[model samples]
Target: MVAVKITTVSTRLRRSMRAHDDYAVRVGRRRLLVTVTAHPGVARRWVHTTLWRHARRLRSVDGITVGMGVQWTPPFRAMKYGAEPRPCTLQLCVGHRCLVFQLAHAGAVPAVLRRFLADARAAFVAYGVRSDCRKLEEHHGLKVARGVELRRLTGMGNASMERMQCRS
Candidate 1:
């Protein structure tokens, strides 16, 4: 059976407690956020397919949006505890001079996480990002989509105190 993988990318809107999460590509000042989740084997396959399909289109320096919805679990749980859905959603934000991409597919092995990363890496370079693909690939487990921005994050880049505090 085909397996499914889920991933996300986002950016920080403001350095405030109430900053909103921007999951689209747009001209703005914020940090780039990305997340990839899948069983190791399946993730490899999906990532490969995704990167091969969209690499060429991302050869620009302008921000673009890409979103993919796959079976997944929310980062956290809320009131009911463990009430999050199994088939979760994944989103990301490349930035003003960035591009966003989403992939929703099913599979057992060779998930789509790799493809998503590869495309993102190409896009990042198109936007003038001087990053190392190998390092990013190793660190993130998935292939390097664009820039190695994730390598720059020290803590939870996507997790916001306000959002976390909000009703999950």
Candidate 2:
């Protein structure tokens, strides 16, 4: 097992008012250091300085792993028909790094992230990718140009990767 280190980017900002937090996590040979931020500037800087830099060294065969979750605005709200839930988080893992973006706090998706998702050379791998792509476009106006559905590749049903692996 690897240790995880977490630290705040700005000590001057109050805990509740801080825009983001930095996390340094190690999993196997991967070193995932990402800043969870809703600020567009911070997110763009991270993408250009860290994500794109790392992506340059990766081969085309090594694709990015994507995951996301949706949440209701009101925590205890009853489900309403035809209402679309907002995406709360988006996680992008590639090579040795993984970035987790707090979408609920971000008023709009960062241009850098949108560019990444639209990059034709980068292949995103996720379960239920079509649904994820649709939700992203509908809510944030972000388009995913290319992606591969893990379920289709593996011939798995609705079960997640974790649950499927556990069964095996």
Candidate 3:
């Protein structure tokens, strides 16, 4: 992945806010909101691939370097657990140190998925980012970051401003 410096400054301001998907990535000072299909695996793949494929072009508009490659880390069990836990892992090295999000199923993985993960990981390493998310976090916390969890939200379509919501 490549990096770019943000330069465009918006002068016109509007009070209206448009709805957007929860997942997004930030490189340099620019933010991108992209839509991916709901499947975690497919979403993960698209995130990395899309960034890499469009990095150069994107840089022209935003003055950043986006690289085409993925670095996927091996799945590890969570630190605490009574029973089995869902696999939470990372994909990296797409577009200047970007990491793709994903969820892995239990037991052995299929060969194709394994290969994709490995390829992504290798590409990530090739781009020189520390593929481990925890290491990255420990080193740099809450800097140019975005995340989403299955939290409860009350809303009708885009009518979220006045809704009350609860989650467990």
Candidate 4:
């Protein structure tokens, strides 16, 4: 498994961050806390471990909606010819942090991520989310896809789209 991780290079991710905190992401608008991932590495393993470790807390959300975006590469674009197109950049937003899952194959997403996403949908107070459940299942192999559109409560509206960055 290649694993998946989210780094806030776009939006502001901060929580009680210190001036000298190595894990701190930024200063000012960004609190720069390791609140997102525990291990704080440039690898997806760390993200998986952190989320897995805190699964209980994550699943306990009153309501969680994730904003998602898709990207198409040269190969996909070449075949598109203005076709319906396919998904590439899979971005998911919870609060201030956006977890951009740059899938090698959107349809072939890792089982663990699918599991977490499903759990988040079930636990979060997304009872009011009106999403394309059918489309999500057909394309992403999951019952629900979370995002700013998914989250009417605290998402950055359309800004969420521009703010989310593909974890490089």
Each model's TM-score, in the order given?
A: 0.25, 0.70, 0.29, 0.44
**Per-residue accuracy of model 4 over 16-74 as CA lDDT, tens digit each:** 33311123444335652333322213224433764755557666654443444444454
lDDT of 3 by residue, 1-168 (tens): 324334453322222223213344454466654332224445545555654676575456333322322223443655454333332434433343243333332232233433343332223222223333333334322111222111121223333322312210
lDDT of each: 0.37, 0.66, 0.35, 0.43
- What RMSD, rounded to one decimal, does every model reach? 15.4, 6.6, 16.5, 11.5
lDDT of 1 by residue, 1-168 (tens): 434333344444432222122233222334443333333443453345444555565565643344322224354645365343333323333332222222223233234545554554344331112323443333334454545333233233455534333422
Q: How accurate is candidate 3 locally (lDDT)?
A: 0.35
Clashes of each: 43, 0, 10, 12
Count of backbone collisions in candidate 1: 43
Which residue pairs collide in model 2, if any? none
Q: Give the Cα error of residue 54 in candidate 1, in Å.
A: 0.7
* Best prediction by lDDT: 2
Question: Which stretches in model 4 have alpha-carbon errors above 4 Å?
Answer: 1-28, 31-47, 59-68, 72-83, 93-98, 105-107, 120-136, 145-151, 154-168
Instruction: Record all residue pairs in model 3 with backbone atoms less than 3 Å apart, i.e. clashing.
Output: 1-96, 2-96, 4-64, 70-120, 70-124, 71-120, 71-121, 71-124, 72-120, 72-121
Report lDDT (Cα) of residue 4, candidate 1.
Answer: 38
TM-score of 1: 0.25
Per-residue CA lDDT of candidate 2, range 1-168, in tens? 434454333222222327677766654445566566777776777677655575754345654454433333554676688766766677776654456677878877778889988876666778778877787788788788887787766777778866655544
CA shift of 34, model 3, Å: 6.5
Model 2 gets an lDDT of 0.66
Once superposed on the true structure, which residue ranges of model 2 sit more than 4 Å away at CA? Answer: 1-17, 28-30, 54-75, 155-159
